[model samples]
Target: MPLVHIDLIEGRSEEQLRQMVRDVTDAIVKNTGAPAEHVHVVLNEMKKNHYSVGGVLKSDEK
Candidate 1:
């Protein structure tokens, strides 16, 4: 089994997230030779305020 963790700023639609999971899982299965059913993808969405770049919070920048 393969476990994939993806983190990004929250904003994607349900469909987008679903597609993302599917694509990532497919890639993992292809690269690791794992079965599709055994591939797991976990998405973690973070608030803009929780992410910082160059010492500046995303929420505070714009």
Candidate 2:
């Protein structure tokens, strides 16, 4: 089985997130020849305030 992990900031619509996972799964399946049922996807969503860049929290960005 192949595992794919993904992370993104919170707030995307369910459909959008679903599409993203599907795309990742498709890519992995095509490249690795893994069966779709055997591929595992993990989606990690964090709050904007929990992530930072340049010492500024993502929630604080303009």
Candidate 3:
């Protein structure tokens, strides 16, 4: 089994998320020779207020 962890800021559409995971799974399977059924994708969505860059929170960005 192959496990993949993806962390991103919240607000993406469900379909976008689904497509992202599908593409990731396909890449993992292609590179590692892992079966598609055995690939594990874990998505961690961080709140805009909880994520920051250069001392500014994502939620506070214009």
Q: What TM-score fits each model?
A: 0.92, 0.95, 0.96
Q: Report how far residue 53 has shifted in candidate 3, in Å.
A: 0.4
- When sorted by lDDT, best at the front, the candidate numbers are 3, 2, 1
Tens-digit lDDT string for candidate 1 (1-62):
89989999998999999999999988988898999999988899999999999999999985
Backbone atom clashes (below 3 Å) for every candidate: 0, 0, 0
Per-residue accuracy of model 3 over 14-35 as CA lDDT, tens digit each: 9999999999999999999999
What's model 2's TM-score? 0.95
Cα RMSD of all models vs. native, in order, equals 0.9, 0.6, 0.6
The TM-score that candidate 3 achieves is 0.96
Model 3 C-alpha lDDT versus the unseen true structure: 0.97
Error of 1 at 11 (Å): 0.5
State each model's CA lDDT, in order: 0.92, 0.94, 0.97
Per-residue lDDT value at 35 in model 3: 95
List the lowest-lDDT window of 10 residues for candidate 1: 25-34
Q: Ranking by TM-score, best first?
A: 3, 2, 1
